[model samples]
Target: MSWRTPADALRNELIELFLNHPTESLSGETISEHFHISRTAIWKHLEHLESLGFVFDAAPRRGYRLLSTPDILFEPLLQPHLSTHSLGRSVLYRPVIDSTNRWAMELAEHGAPHGTVASAKEQSAGKGRRGRMWASPEGGLWMTLVLTKPIPLSRAGELTLLAGVAAAQSLRTLTGLDIRIKWPNDLLLNGRKLCGILAEIRAEAETVHTAVLGIGLNLTVAREDVPALLQETMISLSPSTSSPWTKARVAGAILSALEPLYDSLCQDAAGFSGVRSEWIALCAHMQRTITVRLGEQVVTGTCVDIDERGTLTIEVEGKRVQVPSGEIVRTEVW
Candidate 1:
């Protein structure tokens, strides 16, 4: 459960009205008359918006003026920009949570609908691939999408790749930065990590009951916000020269790109092949000599291709080695 109240709906409408007239001041009398509510109710809603980081300027005669809006991923701010059919239709936002993925998995088990999204401003126990800990803090996008439909266990890897493709494309379009996907589940920017994706499955026997896809991006993260150990290896998405990209806009873009690809993969088998090609195109280490660490075992090889099943095929020694799961610990070019 979300903490949404009946008042949020009216507040969302009020937000829209202010957004439409961004420069003009909205008089309390006009707002109350438009919403058919009392002046005190409008003031309360405005106060709530202020608490959520919306700054307002009020005058005796001129009324309230929208000074600035925060970069937070509030659902109402994102809803108007979203163009997806199902993905992110219902978003559960938390100021702080253990993990969006953890909460989303619990919701999926309890029959949460497909395309339900969970997000948080900060995550205490955020996850990464292969049980690694992700650094999730304020000024970042920590989110999860729950898929309620059952899927075959074999296609789990492809789902992660699909998410990578969606994120890479969206970031490139939104920021015009050269965002690349490293094999497995990392997004790189300027040879440094900018985002990570982790896909978890809840299943009984061999059938996957639910697939939870979590993404964490370093958008608007300051140097002090990142852990000291990862400062050198990670990069943040800074605002472009043209305009600042808000967390809500970035979230909406990624979700919009993901929903159709997800539907295509679940509905059509051939869609995985297309996703594989896109992943390869956006891949950061294709055809490069790299060393992968599989626990105690390590293998060095040239990245060849990603198969339809999302296996990273490497040319090691004289033959092709299929790596189903491993960490690319070292890259030659990056």
Candidate 2:
């Protein structure tokens, strides 16, 4: 069994105490007595929490009060709420990283166990499909799930679709938002991009050795902080609804929703069929005209259906053409 450090356990307890009384100040003596720790230890623990971005207000006689909670994916705050079997069994959290996907890939290559998760507060070099740079500022969900189980290489595409489904379902359950999956690996809210999924796999011949599924979700990004080029195309989740959401809460929900789907995909082929059906039902572009860009070629057609292998089938020139992968340039609704 994995054990938490004494300091970490104390920190969590302190956080819970603060959370239980967000508006009230708790005296140092009270906190120390409650936890059965020395006043100096409480001070040290508070300092450590401050270092993790938690804000506290202190006065000579008024004791200490939590000013604000950090917008970080702290494991202590997330683990209690997480209801997943394996997806987030071993989480590696970093304050900042070049890319969670890159880090997860390195760990997988070095024998990281399956269901390990790598998450970061911010990613300096996040990437999307077609080698496009993804803006991963603070207050967004940037994480990667490492899958070590061996499966057919052809099933890799389906796994990517499954990640999209998990994210969409999780958001819908949390906020009651109208979330929809866009083709292979994107979740859209009211026709705007809310989340992006990228799946990378390493395979020999037809067998897969490992796969890393990376997801970037915009939870609380400010409108001004968004890049000017993507202001209209991209959106954050907080602005659309009045419901308050924390980064750790949303992250836990995503993991909880993904765990069962991951188990089904690895254990039963029939389970993948159900995933595909749900994906199709949640797809935003079905029967809609879309332009897909493949290298130098662009095909404009009406999206008819997605096949068993998760290939998009679009009707072009009275014929249905299956597009294994491509960039969707535009979607036109009838």
Candidate 3:
């Protein structure tokens, strides 16, 4: 559910004020006067802030001071960092949800505007490619961007590839890591999975009505928080960087990166050729031998190229094969 109540709005504004002046305190009288509300109402908002993991120290004459904030992504804390024209104009931040993609789909079905974003601190039913369960614990970034503008259904796969570029660029800028794109929608850092992007489109016949782009980024999840089976394969971004990472900042960076790409895709379907070329350059398994699982059949071949329409081209048994959709199960250098 979205924050719609008057009290919730007031609490968000109060948090924004405290974020602007983290070290300084704001008097109850000042807050009440600013919002044109009573001191009792101001106290109520402060109490709600504490419930959402905000700690404030109150004094008799000094006022209330923000001591600390939770690691979760709060909209007030995230908005100031975003400079995008569209992507995150309307954000729905839920502390926990079943899945950001599912929530975004529901919102789009109900006529949510383009560039609406849904984010969660934790997802109980996060999903990956091929219906695999994505381990989404706390301290990770789980977000979905909804695009309501109409585009061709044929370009849906290219949209996924575009999202990969946006995510890779954002990660590279923030962590200074050698980030690589893995095939259609995964991002890797130093040969380990760092982020995954899933683009789901709702279309009619040949026209696309809406597309939901979901991104699951492994930020600061603890080793114990991840499933034991994925420990060897999946990795987080925290261990590779010297500085700490904030979900809000990383999320803003991704949305900022996606705005222009999404605009390009909406303008023309052929615009994806640039995105496809960039994906090929950043792909980790490009020109390497890999196994792709396509439904019941698995194809083992050398990764050759990704076409303008986002199909993976592979050379199998001296023959060129185009795979429109599949999962790269394994990759071998030689």
Candidate 4:
């Protein structure tokens, strides 16, 4: 069965006609004559297009011309650019929400399939690794992508690193800034945090049921709202140095860039490795010393390499050991 009704398809075609027509306006009579439909049908299609958030300019000389398009995550804006499947198939858009990730979790529980995306203008209770409160105001892109691939639970950590590369590359493309990935999933400008990714997963027996990938970047937020403790954790493309971009466009670019990377992941494990090397080259603390806060075990060591599994290989006590999980820190945690 077709996903659209005849009227829906007709309405979409009418909007495209005005948008793509060489002339400024095609009169209702002209469209009716061209499509062999009645003038009233043409007018009805225009009305339907208007309800879908399109700007139509009607003039005496020119019957109708498309003026502006909706900036929301509507299909008109995204479907033209989206090329990946399943990863971003469904989108839940909102002007405001408590948290995109929270809502995505609920949706996943109720059988939302892989590649479902929940996006919001702002998040009231956003968070990061270690349950740290995340402040997601209106200026940044807040999204949580859901997936249920059949990968080992132990391999789950790698996806966060994958998300970091996607976020960093998207920012670079949008602002022309040299963004870097910090250890794990922090996007860094110079040495401060510009964006973060939080990966949540739920497994059943030997299979995975849900994976939520949450991303938040400070696109436009008051510097004072950043907690004093997070002063070092918050960074943005300074107005003088960065080109201004709308939050909606930023969100669009993120999904656009993520689609291919996700496809590569599904094709082969080497795809994840290739992206990991690029991440290491762009990481802020690749060869430097940092502390890994693993519960009460605070060990300060030189950061060596992050394996494909996303574990940090640290040189501590003259022995090379891999720290599987911890809150990576640039300073001594002890």
- Which candidate tops TM-score? 3
lDDT of 3 by residue, 90-110 (tens): 777778899999999988877
Residues 1-334, candidate 2: write the lDDT tens digits. Answer: 2323467656767987988888998998899899999989899999988887999999877789999887676655677668976777666667889999999998887766788778888899998987888888887889898998777776777788878888898899899999999877889988888999999989999877889999999988776776788778788898888987887788888888887777777774644577777888798999999999988999999999887778889999999998998888899741
For candidate 1, give the lDDT: 0.84
- RMSD, one per candidate, in order: 2.9, 4.2, 2.2, 5.0
Pairs with backbone N, CA or C atoms under 3 Å apart (clashes), candidate 2: none
For candidate 2, the TM-score is 0.83
Q: On a 0 to 1 TM-score scale, where does candidate 3 land against the true structure?
A: 0.92
Sort all candidates by TM-score, best to worst: 3, 1, 2, 4
By lDDT, the better pick of 2 and 3 is: 3
Q: Against the unseen true structure, what C-alpha lDDT does each candidate score?
A: 0.84, 0.83, 0.84, 0.73
In the range 1-334, model 1's lDDT, one tens digit per residue, is 5334467557767877888899999899999899999999899989988987899999998899888877776666788768998787766667789998999888776666788788888999999877878989897899999987666776767888888999999999987888999988899998999999999987788677788999999887776777899989988897523567788889999999988778777764655687777888898899999999878999999999888888888999989998988899999877
TM-score of each: 0.86, 0.83, 0.92, 0.77
> Candidate 4: how many backbone clashes?
1
Clashing pairs in 3: none
Of candidate 4, the 10-residue stretch with the lowest lDDT total is 1-10
